[model samples]
Target: MRTADTEPEPASDHDGQHFVVRLLDAWYVACQSRQLRQRPISRRIFNTPIVLFRGSDGRPAALLDRCAHRNAPLSLGTCQDGALECPYHGWLFGTDGGCQGIPALCGSQPGRGHRVPRFETQEQQGFVWVYARADVEPKTTPFVFPHVDEPAYATVRYQATSPGTLHANLENILDVPHTAYLHRGLFRGVERNKVTATVRRFAKHAEAEFVGEPVPKGLLGRILAPRGGTVVHFDRFVLPSIAQVDYALGENHVIATTALTPTRDDEVVLNSVITFKTVMPRILIQPLLVPIGKRVLAQDRAMLKAQLQRIQDFGKEQFVSTEVDLLGPHIWRLLRQAARNVPEPQETTPDLPAVFENTVELMA
Candidate 1:
């Protein structure tokens, strides 16, 4: 099998165009690992149709969904002998996307070599990621959910699709003040709090930390912070659309990371994994945790949908960022740099601030 470095000639799709070529080169989560079984499942990322399936050896394979001959969707066909069979003409395509057998031709070779685009796919951290570029490898491995595999931590995973830009979702996850108002009774703080936050930015990453915040009074606090103390909250934005938020309540900590992948310009697939190290046993508290987490996610989804609709109608974004919107600017800086395959200079407007602190006042 050829490595991702050896790309086939670009697919005839619009993605081959120069304008979007760079964006397509980056790796994006195509679907959850559990979703692809022996039978094929079709999904589209960056507007490229892909059919994902597991070969007889149990490794995942991704192929352009269109059949080489009739352009029939290979996903509608069946998997046999470790290859996908085109239902329309009974043509079999091997894992490498090369046409192998044609029923009509019987032992005779089908003239004119043909193959569909096969994308580079890797499965890690419970998700399947694909590089849309016909012949490029991802610069790094998929984002790691370190706690998920750790024996000491218990993790709960949640997924949803939001009708918003990936940047919008990233901003929402890292925004702290919204928790009080948007998640009033669930994860918000009750009293007006004066919080001190520091935002630090580096070459390809950024983070914000909030200090002197009171223990959350919402359901999350009830379960994870039964014995209250100061809560130290931190938010970070990793390159290529990943947000990590951690809340430390004394010795117990609640950490969640959300990885966002753009399915389209206005739609993003979000995978959120929340892990906790608490006094209570994980198996005992897992059930309660999922519902509360879901409640919070639902609220975020509603707000994002409303925000997307407004942007769609207005045809532009003109929102203002304040001192509290510390993560937003840095997120854009790194993401835009990565998209352009450019490295952010050590000094520039919105340059990585080694460390910067501010005070934000909010009425919960």
Candidate 2:
């Protein structure tokens, strides 16, 4: 059996916390095409703010965001060949974030003092990802969908950031019971009572299987929820922080990863990516398919964001946990643990691969 103390402590009760060290990875809401088109997008990557700009030669550059001369946001400046021009003093920094030119002073050479710190960055799957701490690197490869990765998936991403918590959103999807009620007309139809499910966990991940029904209970009930083989859905919490969702929607096996990086104490920006595996040839149907997928995705995001805001405004009240709340509470615990991923100011980046909580300990 488990008690409250044995489970990971909530961030709300933890005395001090930082975002960078807590999560193993962070995803930037970047558009590779859009990023390359004009000026770079200026976004805060977790606790550390950063400036990204494309040079005249069209190479992407990332700087520590603060100008070398003074602590000013360099993103508010212009771009030269692989360099960022600081708006504050008009100091131009190269792709490596080295100060290239100082407009005010005539310099014999751009001294070492003119350089700004740089971070590790990768532009993939039409987004940019930044690693704040220099020493850390990814253990497993980032999830890239072959279908989307194909030069075909016609993707256009838009982000809506709110003052919501990361754990709150992850719980929404992992908690399948909510999907029946919340996304009734959308993700699923009206009748959900036909589907029977049971959940199991491993290491830091938890999964639920629709063991009973593959057919639906309503008009389409028998078609979707037949006398069930199992449809497995597992969620793994990859530490400092990352979440993986694997589920099958008919012929489509979908996997989505959302890395929740903290921007501020009360807010976390989710960098979510989805990959689909389908037997259908994507070329002919992709134009129509991507939009359908995007619409469904948009619906889920709305539910999560709105529910989070509501809880913030009204404040949390105590709830009686039940057998049905099993998957939801179990998920809440794991995500809360990950949300504490930021490293402490004094600690060095951890050498170990991201750790997962003991699921048996949780469910016991």
Candidate 3:
């Protein structure tokens, strides 16, 4: 229950610099655990190239993609015996990025000054996370989905790349009204119901609760809730870049939590975990769940690509907002302040009038 007040401040700028580095000191989803293989895999995060490989004991390891000797890509090299051998000069490097052997010289020095930069990496919740700054430890734990480990809940994992900024896609997932149009038939029914949502912001997180939403008439509705009843939905955002949605119908609840990380200046990698509790065995249900989840994400991916294209063509964003834009503005402000290493203004007044219940009407 740590509020923004207790959260550590973002990394401070050095040498009189004003802006704090955005990804430094944060843990970002580098790739799914399954994506790593016996061969080294190259991944780029925060616009920096990194290579991931498995050690001799099969533990995950990561390092800067470049070899210190010739600046060749270490990812093209071979991995064996918990060490990576550079393809160019047959220089073998251990899991710690230390030079271990040199094929060319029998008595070559294997120690000092011949090493590549290494990064801190951890595998959790089916994803491998890379800490952006080698000097800073992650302050937050990687997100985990509820019921993922429970025997009664069926879980489906998915990954997608969006041609949009981290801010853009984060806002898209929490946006409720967009589903009726952008994801029609797939997520929402043709019928438009006036839904009300109450939004509140805390120190490090924010949430929107939707009330008066009728049972959806789409395919998802039939799968999640056949007998129509009032649906309780919550859209939430956590610090850094985590967005999740929960749909509750009586005792059964379906949840999808997505962790987004910036792979480039204009692109983000999405790692999603979808889980639900049901009477049926998960083995029978997972096959049906995967396809539907993929379809919904496909629609979102397409829409975000189009939006990014529009921004590129116009050279800037032309946008307007109403009170219903409950979370977008807040998210933008948080990013802006974090970039400058400034404290959140609302952190001091947790019970401010604006932080309390307020509702917005939208068609769902």
Judged by lDDT, which candidate is best?
Answer: 3
Model 3 bad stretches (over 4 Å): 1-21, 279-285, 346-357
Clashes of each: 1, 21, 1
For 165-230, candidate 3 gives per-residue lDDT tens digits of 777888899887788887788678778888888887665677889988877888777776677788
Per residue, candidate 1 scores C-alpha lDDT tens digits across 122-195 of 88888888877764456666677768878788888988888777677888889887988999878865677677
Q: Model 3 reaches what TM-score against the true structure?
A: 0.87
lDDT of 2 by residue, 79-186 (tens): 766667777877888877677787777653576666887766676666666665543454444435335555423332334454444555555545656655555554
Judging by TM-score against the true structure, name the best candidate. Answer: 3
lDDT of 3: 0.76
Give the higher-lDDT candidate: 2 or 3: 3
Candidate 1 has which clashing residue pairs, if any?
7-135
Error of 2 at 141 (Å): 5.3
lDDT per prediction?
0.76, 0.53, 0.76
Using lDDT as the measure, name the better of candidate 1 and candidate 3: 3
Candidate 1 Cα outliers beyond 4 Å, as residue runs? 1-22, 106-112, 347-364
Which residue window of length 10 is worst by lDDT in model 1?
Answer: 1-10
